[model samples]
Target chain A: MSEKTLTYEQINDELLGMLERPHPSYFLLLLGFLLALGLFVLSLAIQIDVGIGYSGISHPIGWGVYITNFVFWIGIGHAGTLISAVFYLTRAPWRTAIYRGAEAMTVFAVMTAGLFPLLHTGRPWLAYWLIPYPNQRMLWVNFKSPLVWDVFAVSTYLTVSVLFFMIGLIPDIAIMRDDAILKGKKLKALIFTPLSFFWRGTNHQWLHYMRAYLIYAAIATPLVFSVHSIVSWDFAMATLPGWHTTIFAPYFVAGAIFSGLAMVMTVLIPMRVVFGLEKYITDHVVQSVCRVILFTSIIVGYAYFSEFFIGWYSGDVFERSIFYFRPFGAMKEWTLLGDQSIGFPQVAFFLMVFCNVIAPIPLWRWKIRNNIMAVWIICGLINVGMWFERFNIVGSSLQRDFLPSAWGSYWPTIIEFGITVGSFGFFFTLFTLFSKSLPAMAIMEMKESAHPPMRKETHG
Target chain B: MGKFSGVWASFEYLDETTEAIEKIRKQGKQPQVLSPCPRHEIDHALGEPQTRLPFISLIFGGLGCLTGYSFPAWTASDWVLPVSGKPIVAIPPFTIIGFELTILFTAIFTLAGMIGLIVIDTFRNPLPKGAKKYPRFQRDRFGVVVSCEPSQTKEFEELLKAHGAEEVHVENS
Candidate 1:
């Protein structure tokens, strides 16, 4: 058979046809964003009224849902850089189709992550005081404090993620600009052209860009790990019997990536189905990601069990007493987390294992790989498990600690709960908008991904 | 064919390009590889070149370490001393800031170096001008440009095409 030649017109026509239909996912995203924005406003308004004191977090539990959400969002930001920069350097073949979105997710998640720290502030205006520069008051930020570290870690993470994401987007933006179908899209793309700094699509340019992208990705991945672990360490180092553990760094990082992967799956599965991109996002990709989820889930499970095992074995009375009473031992004096006086949070620990750990095991089977229904079920469970891990870490640890006098209780207030949900809305909203404006996959990378038996018409 | 000297090879991203130069001695033709992204591999690419990015930036990161750790300490102890008596500039204290700046600059330097070293200006591949006339590259096409002599152009292109290159275009600069 002769090779079939496809003209640029044919490719554009194929792509344009896909874009022509109104993506239902876009509407879902819009609705979600609006509601989330509404929740953000409502939560802020309530915090103003109740005076940061209105909700469940108080005293020992001073960090409740806000901190958890902060951590959760930060974790969500991790996968993107991992996908883009890390894999780029490693030269993993599968990264081509997904890295673009992952980087975008990193930027937006960082932005979203920033908002929580801003919202949690008693005097949001005073946050500028944390800046490392000398001010009119000549104030220096607190170096010994986890809060200060968070400010630095989070900001650094945000800044680098944003810079790296922008650099990578430059080439793609140019491609989108030239597409006739983008309509005013080309104008929009040109608006960014100057910022792209004269990207003319030369071989040398690709060489430089690829190098920068890889180097940044490599550096950024480890930073994200350290940043989140530092955030977790904020509590771990606090002498709170339950919080102090060396494993907190890797454990928190594992949880972060575990949740991050789940969040990606949640967004991706729907996006794949909704965008009708079943062709581009094959079952193989889903299977590969599930493997990551499974891997992280196991790490999280080990962290969970290790915390219990070590605490019991350490013979530190405070650690032993707190571990016994709060969740595992079912001591009423210490059992503080949920409807279960023995505390449901321990149950959450198990469920986190179930959804993130045990649940995806079925994915290892070839049959389940093709079973969209089973994948969706597992995806939902993963989202639940990741969220529960946050709850268990933030809530369970705070329920009982070094001193009964210092211990306080927590539950998400209606506003806090709504805002947390809203964050997801905004996350989806931004993703949907980005998907429409840009190539869902990295076209250049995909084209360059050389495989054996190269010939025209081989692609599906 | 391009000439080479000694034990030269280029495979991994981080392997310096100078390693390629070493391999030149064993071959009839000089060889080069296209890594997915820029890396320390370029040092090898540049010929056993030792770049001072680490020594220079280590100084910066250590300075960052000083400021990130000490800034908080100075503020707490000397300036807005807290009721809590938290130790100022604790070593464990500045890890994130130390880490952040260390990373931040490392990334910034890496990105800047990439731009400076690679000089990625214009793109050589795209849909192409007559793309409305051709679309094969988009579907699935990987083109590797092997720098070689005029006599060996046909030979190498044939080899690469057999190795899954769909099309080969050779031009003399």
Candidate 2:
């Protein structure tokens, strides 16, 4: 028997039905959020009143969990604009399904990323001092700082992405405008109205939309690539032995996309259930993204080896010593100081190989890719592995730099861990609200996806 | 006075342009067939009429390319100093930057051209304050708008009737 199609009323009734008691998982998710939020607040407040000086942030490991989280979050944000604009322009059809959610996630994630650096600052209020405000202080912003470049790059990338996302929404707003189902409802239309930009979806309007989408995609592609590479430049620009390398740009960018894709899969799991949109975003589409994961995994693998090979080939002792010390440093001191790592680099290499390289090999097979449960499980492991990979690169490297005296091991303090979880809470809260409210997928894009303009049949 | 007028239908999902051409040939009517999607097939169906769109795209794409590269370069180079030890003006990096700008300009220009040519952006639903013969068009609906000379309205209406039009109406515009 055919299941009766649920009308807008039924869907709404079901949705509204849940609001009375909140979600079954809502209490748990909320409790986690509160605990995390409280811890983050306490951490920052203590630090601000006292200082990041109070934490384990010492000389050699200048950047601790704060900066690491910042980089990781920003990297995760990369895949969204990359999918929306870059993939769209290239005519990757699967993009229409997953791109919207990821794009929204991108905006929120960037916002989350922007928070950490500020929190980690010596004076949070004076953070604006970093920007060159034309106040009478006669103070000039440092033009030669990678941090300065980051402010501009990340902000510009965010602005352009928001513009692009809003531009795409204009036609849909018109549809919603005429839709009787949406009569007398106002859903923060203030944000949406500017986006609509008075779009009417007429032939002329469509023409404009098509042109805008293509051009924006084109502009955004490089911006997306540049943002993460620039983020890596923050590390590469530093004079640290392992961090300062030409290979850092490509290496960081590849790792970014690798982790970013894993995130996309993780987000997709919850989104599929809540939106009742399994059909719109299918297992086949989910599996197709694994190919991206596989490809990026290999590239990151090459970059990892490439960095080590280059270090050996160039015969740079400082670089070699730092690399060696990361994992198998002569820890005759028997302390887990920066000096006492038991093969951190080797461990990093194998762990990355396992998580990013080997673990994904099962996905190459058709069965595993198609298995929704297995896909979700793999995507979860992939995310955990990605976090570890970042730890190995940033954390371990910080603990074991060229100067052993300055080097020290750093772990995320209670507050540090809390803030990280808080960021996740913020991301999820925004995403959950977005999914529940907005059309989970782009209806217009999906409509067009199944029936694109056909190529003319050729005759010899 | 302009001569031919009639209605036509085509399988938009499957052989769209040919079906349109065959229908037009049978009636021998010089009617217009505006499709939801712009395709080369439609151009063939309409005898591949010359349009200034491609030229517009080229000109605009060029303009976009120029601006995308130059604007950022100028801002980062002449207007601003180098953020890192990197030079005041970075050219190699412009490959992605330049490419993106060109696409941006082309899109904007194309939009302007579309509004200027198709005249849809100006359409505040000017036909009537609340006229909706086909609300479905707001969603997934597509069609060929078969417009002919006003004198041939009767035959055109009949032709539209014969081709199994779900609905038909006269346009005030």
Candidate 3:
């Protein structure tokens, strides 16, 4: 429907209708994720039983796929906040339709990211020790550790993102509740009534709600930058060659937004199709998101070059060695299949470059960016590339440290692979269920943007 | 059922709604406007000051920052563990903790204040009986609810209809 022809009631019905009956494909998708989750659980069970050593992490390369997945998932959450909080503050109109889905993505992605640390610790039950509580021993978590900083940052990000999301959803949920009452869907009404907090859209509620929402947007904007910066500190504070650098903060933030926007597209393109939100999620919005992806891709590409340039320029032998060994195999001498010689580190490096830098270059052209299929495929590549990017940083740096004698290769076992897949399953499963249950688009905001019904022309 | 009652009028258009609110205020009575979404025009017509929730957020945010910094500083001083010859209480790292908590507390308290104010307003100026029965006010319509006596119900309804109200109801309980 054209913007002019769209009425408030139509906007309400179209957006809220998504929460009604689901298509079989949604259940199929949910079921597929559940199976992956089951695999994740089984893998966790096996790892806990057999110990964390069952995974590919060994001497010299302690932080492996789990840390990479942790960073990757955390990075995936940034685009949602960027869209919801940052874009909202800037009064970006296109964000109105996409922000809700992106905010939901942020909440779910953070929840998924929160699990990896627990999984990595191997003793999930004792994870509470990370909290700075006064225990029987009078011991507190070290305030100086970046890991502790990460705990504060990620948990805070999760809480703030959830509040921002729910604050945005309140008016829409109230609409759903009213609709449920109108339709006599008592179960849905029963569920949404409390969620709506007895919202009646009185001027009293909207006055405070609008002010509070703006404050949320303001606070959440800095939070989006801080959470990932703190996550970067997890690496930058380390003494490792490739991992320790001043640029990691901005570089990781850029990469996080890049991967996050890709994941948003990865989720939203399919969602717009499934929910018939093509009108709201128009080509303009898709192209706008692509432009951002392209811009962030350039920053990531620059960061990569800058890392190498700084490595060679700094004349730090260890840094130069790690940088050199990243692209060229540290174990190039090992031959396989009668003359074929390839190292996993080299392969990961090349894959990361190809996915992160080269894949998104086509988005500069309007035609290519406009092609939904092409954009979707590139987004998928960006996702893979981002994971490999984290892998290259986490794995390649550790595989060859300062002491050559300490150098060792890391390969993920089946259990690690299962857990990684399970993480995706966990993220998508919650996302799919969320899309079905909540207003996928900000309905009230859309109406607020559109021309309200007016009969008399009062310019004043 | 009480000495005071309410007259609820629903307008199909924003112009008429705001005009009615302006007229009601001119008549020396406070009018509550209900809208599907907030409008600057309605705010202008009602002339209520901006919500003070931001002050609440700022106060809580300051407290959070103090707590975040002090908790870590006090703990480090008490424990007195020396690592890498760094300061007993590192300011740079603790700033990260402080910053995060500032935002966290600001957000939590902003929401709390908004909810608290909404609850207080709901009790103080409760909606008329079956006010929500006109659900259009939650979707398309704008509603102007004014306090009036049972004797003034007809006069208020006539005033609302004159201002192009599509529907008007009076509750004398």
Candidate 4:
């Protein structure tokens, strides 16, 4: 653990330099992602052209890969608000270095998640019907359904997250504006000067700026908890045995924060490596993030336990079947994720438990927690685990429902898998571009935190 | 009329800038302090007024909540679409919309308030002629721009230099 202190000029020069001259690898990485993005778009087009029938979704398992991907992406989005808003409100200083990336992740994750519902809706053309508006049809959106609640929840989450991300950037942009003028980057100066809002660091402007920032943080805090809870209700509101559970809300919220924190590390580790931001990002920040991951992992572990315990204790047949079948039931015939006839996906269940619950156990040791490689590996595992968690939740539950006759298994078609991979490509593409454009680290806030003002007596 | 001349002095440290602002205030001249970052001490020393952003956000949030609840309630009642035999204006489910809207509106109001305040302040007292663009103030330096008559320029410059100014320049209007 090196405690390397950085100066304002050093920080400015190192971070802003990325924007000035990108590394060769940057273009190569982006080109690869662009290819993936093109492939993803192609898959989406094919799905649309061929219709929803191209998907593995069938009766009783209508929500397959699309819904799972939706939940997974939305879960990944959680850590952003948690890091930027919740940690700030709680007075955590370490968040200053890593929050910019996490916040950007949240925005992009939501953007990616926003697409799934439309994709899931076979008639993408009529997706606007989800919005409540007056038209010749006079048909209004149903406000009572949890699905309707989801439309409101996800959209509001996206809007607020974007605003928070941009608001946090104004001071940094002002810095860029000034730096541009000094460096004689005419084009950058022309673009950033106006966007800087002519900020002169006046007393009045600072006063309003600080107040507005605090209020935004205050409002965004609850949203960190609410948006995911509503997403959970999309399942909990249903009458299905595995879906309808009182524990679903908190359970889903905890899992969301858990997965989101892991994603932050996943994004930041490579980021720090490429950008050479180790001095600013530091081992201490990684340790802090890992500690949060450990805490959330414990909560998720508890939720997993409580869910099964309740299922067994309630003695409900349907609940018991879903629970028992999740971890134990091996099948001579089963549906693989890609719709292939397979032996059993019972492995996914145990893998989910191992990744989510057991993998984080190493983080309990300070030595392992501080080790970047170890943290990175564990965080990556958590990402995989959380995805499996969603898969098990959506797939296992639908695999064996109340009526054995209505029960069936689901495997994502090639299109589903391709679209899933493409979503990551989309996320990374936006993030890579974002890394170069704005101050990836909030320069102004970092400066404020690192070097606060020192008062001096008046000289008369 | 070019009657007033502005002397802008750059300080390497915040302490020097704060001291300069206080000295200028004692001399009955309001000096503007610019730095790369915002400081609470500077705001306190200048007696900056509190922002109305919190209040505005609250008002908008309340209105949004009301609209969130009323629009759904009204539409449900008007359309008479009872879901699962539950009341058209089901209070339990309506809270979700209300909660979401509250967050949405607060964010909207807060953003609007911030931009409005900055723009209004910028328009009311546009930056001093040459004071409009100083890049160093956003670097590791602080600036104090004093507005005074042309005759006071030499005095202000001497005052700043004596106190400790790395560089001093003047812009006359």
Candidate 5:
């Protein structure tokens, strides 16, 4: 099933054939996610009803699981644009098969990421106050605030990603429209017609389409770097020891790309199997992605080492103490059940290190990277590790900030855990729906990469 | 077929399609080529100018950058709220807003320009009648459509067949 053997017709049938009918397993998987979404909704309802106090976020550890989830989800989104825009600009051919899914993942992950800041704001309804609209009070959002920057950065990322995704879909959707008309699916044709924007594949339309798409990729490339850098600023701009550092921007960006590539593998490996896209999403593509993940993982590990090195070398006691506390901090006497507990922050630090750094080292081997199951498992570990990485950064830094009396352990409540699980449910639900509804792979791009059908003899 | 005077030719091969387009062009007709995907060969044969989308994006993106910085500066000045002993309008911090807005505005208006140009072209040079019947043009086939007088339609159809057109349809007025 080499891509070289695939003609345009075969590619169309294999790709578009995915949208034709769903297997029962698809429904079952969707149902599982919907049930999880129900848990998310139930948790949100309780939080809104009982007040934000129900969550474990207390005085010093004000940002807990919600903020961690926010950063984690946003990090997960970075790979999409990285693969779509960055790889596109570089002319990476392997990107054609898998980037569409990555782009979709980005949109959904960002959509999920956006919920946290709203959820973090005890009154989600007044979230609009972050906007700089004129009001009777004549108040404006402090542009100097990193939090305000997050608001602008995240919104702009979401908008730009969606537009880029839809613009890429036009030519493919036109194929879907034609396929529907051929099958005499009047209903589908009616729906796809407008979605395709009446695309006729005319040279006039394509000339402009090509230019516009290139411009989008160009703009979006910078956006991918900026959004995450700005997110890191939310911490870096702060004066807190571990939270405030110049290295956070690049460190966070690398960690984001690391985690995001892992998430892309987490979704794509399963999708490639389920949709029978072996020829398109080949092992070469998987290995290429693994190399990126491995490269980024090295950067993340270096960032971790540098943070510790700087803390020790800079002779800043507060920084030195926070770095020490991250791994060997004392646990609070009280736990979720009012019992003595192990040091959760230390455990988080170790887990993050083990998952983010140690787990990915196996991928350095050619055989290991080629093993899809092994790659998938390691990717799962990276996902867990990356989340703990954020948890460690957000929770541990705040737990023991400046004074002894201010030191307190942060443990997520049952409600917080529920919402976290629910976020997964929401993300998966949207993704599963997207897989069935749209062309998960970029069809036209695939054809462009393939050897076009040519006659044996040229006509003079 | 009243008031319809054109010829539509379909080819199964890319080279043949480009060859057909070249042959049609040599006869003083600027034929329209349709493809399932963008091809450098077709673009070369068509010889259209580079698109103006970049200019649109640049103009709007610059506007956005100005507005992003100035709006925040003006608001901070009007309100006169200063924190952390920073200036009333900090250029460094506002630069983030400017950067984000530059990308946002560039993307939105670039999209608008693309759609606007497509719409204008669609109205000015609508696809030939019976083009919809050749849905293969959207999937696998390549098409060469030429508008001509009824007297010349037969000659054009023969030219298309001579150059490896798998199918040719004549539209008559």
Candidate 6:
């Protein structure tokens, strides 16, 4: 697809115009999300005040919905890193249009994911004990535990992601600073000037800026892969049949990029529409992302197949039992037929297989992949599928263990469901605000690649 | 402000900007190139030396990786609190921490290098004592500031104007 030719002034006017006067729909969407955030906070307050038991975790199914949500949100954060760092390193041109929004999603998704472990701990206040700080109690966090590794992985991911996002923003902030001055927005100018570091775009500044950006991009690629891999270890290190697998690392990472790509679609599609950015965010870009989704989906599908094959081939009855029962076990009489079912909840398993494995198949068609509406619906389904994938992994294994006497079904209570819904609200709330205030697209990057006016051919 | 005076010339295109910088340099004056984003051609034209940020980031990241791995290993040895029948200092899992710290410090060092370069080069004055600002320079336009004694300002402005600058402004300190 040919690139849309836009001038520097036109790029600035269109992109920065969104920041200057956000559409009413932006506020309306933000308000709706804020309400969801309110519910999330209230639910979290209840969970803290009452107990972790409010989430409906019991007996053998101790690690229930919260952990599933934690893994899901963390997975959602991965695509951002891949797009911003990996794509930049690889020098994919389309990334310039969509990466800023993806980066924001990464930051907020990590923020949302961080909360779940704290909520799951049932003791949010003592969350600091996870840190390897020198306390007077003469106790250091277990350096050997994957959980401790998780704390470092996640915190470091947040720090690096935020810094990368901010470094990328400096030049844009300088443009915004100038716009603020031109418009006589004193307060905004005041905020942006210092943040811009008086960026005059000197050759010296560019030399350092380019080098720093490249290094951040290089560090971020491995950092992204390692973070999700470490998260997978949080379960892989455990002895449960479904959880104890060597494939979890690559599987989780692939699934993360898959779902993360879907999420990027989920965000950028509506964003492009509401902001009238079809010219910049073109169908060609959507098609490229769809192809990526198709690729990662196959990887995730392979991982799913490998896990079951390994389980059965290992000749371990316990592993075989979990694998067989997870999808085929009949629902017990006392249990509901829905996700809350005690006896081998098959719906989530099949839905996960359907959403994650089957849903992305349509993307193979060039026509459907380019169709924005079709891609959007498929991506939305993939998000649901990935979430259920986590649920099936966490719930199916934990529901029925080795001994029947130790077996138990798990379901989320009202508070648990509220928190889950609120988490979405939380993610979208920050993202909505970000889309309004910051340049959702990288203006400088667009300008860099923008076709300059025909240069005068000099004759020697 | 140390009797600093300069002519800020804004150009709508990179070619004109580079030409203006060259013309200023031919007059034996150093011109500060400014734009909305980095232009490699302009850097080449100005003959600006490459930055040392990559080297600094490599050093910091390598040290960070070493520190991340060794600190935990040393602590494990001193305390001897092994969990889950693993070794006192596990190499496999600790590698995750090492990897994370490496990236973290590389990013921190890279940012520090960028900001430090900016501060030393640009923000040395109490109140904009260095080069002048052309508003378009921060948006779509390219700018070059040829700072000299107050007497040289008119000559610099005329030189920049001759090289196809759209607008030329002067600042005196």
Worst 10 residues of 5 chain A by lDDT: A331-340
Tens digits of per-residue lDDT, candidate 1, A1-460, equal 1012332233334433444546576676577677777777777777766677676666767777877788878888888877776666777666665677777887888888888877778667667777677677776655666887788788888888888877776655544444432355555555755654644443355555655655576677788678778888787878777788898899988877777766777677776676565655667777777777778878887887898799889989888876665556346554454333544567766777677778877877878867777877887787787777777777777777766666555667777777788787667677777767666665445434422221233353
Q: In terms of docking quality, how is candidate 1 classified? A: incorrect
Per-chain TM-score (chain B), model 3 = 0.94
Which one is best on DockQ? 3
The Cα local distance difference test for each model comes to 0.63, 0.64, 0.88, 0.84, 0.90, 0.84
Cα lDDT for residue A460, candidate 5 = 27
Candidate 3 chain A: minimum summed lDDT over ten consecutive residues — where? A331-340
DockQ of each: 0.18, 0.16, 0.84, 0.65, 0.82, 0.65
Q: Each candidate's TM vs. the true structure?
A: 0.76, 0.77, 0.97, 0.94, 0.96, 0.94
Stretches off by above 4 angstroms in model 6 are A1-4, A330-344, A453-460, B1-3, B26-28, B82-85, B123-133, B149-155
Off by over 4 Å in 2: A1-51, A130-140, A181-198, A273-276, A329-353, A451-460, B1-120, B123-134, B143-159, B171-173
TM-score of chain B of 4: 0.85
Which model is ahead, 3 or 5, in terms of DockQ?
A: 3
Q: In model 1 chain A, which range of ten residues has the least summed lDDT? A: A1-10
Give the distance in Å from residue A294's predicted Cα in candidate 3 to where it truly belongs.
Answer: 0.8
CAPRI class assigned to model 6: medium
Name the candidate, 4 or 6, with the larger lDDT value.
6
Regions of candidate 4 where Cα sits further than 4 Å from its true position: A1-5, A330-345, A452-460, B1-5, B148-155
The sequence of per-residue lDDT tens digits that candidate 6 reaches over residues A398-428 is 8766766677777689998999999999999
lDDT of 5 by residue, A1-460 (tens): 6676689999988899889789999999999999999999999999988889999999998999999999999999999999999999999888888999999999999999999999899999999999999899888888888999999999999999999999999999999999989889889889999999989999888999999989999999999999999999999988998999999999989999999999999999999888888899999999999999999999999999999999999999889888987886643432333324447788899999999999999999999999999999999999999999999999988887777766777889999999999999999999999999999999998888877888864432
A1-460 in candidate 3: lDDT tens per residue?
Answer: 5444577888988888888888788789899999998998898889888988899998888899999999999999998889988888888888888988998999999998998899889788899999988789899999899999999999999999889888999999888888878888889889988999988998889999999988888898898888888999898999999989999999999999999999999999998887778889888899999999999999999999999999999999889888988887653443232323357777888999999999999999999988999999999999999999999999988877777767788889999999999989888888988988888889999888777888875452
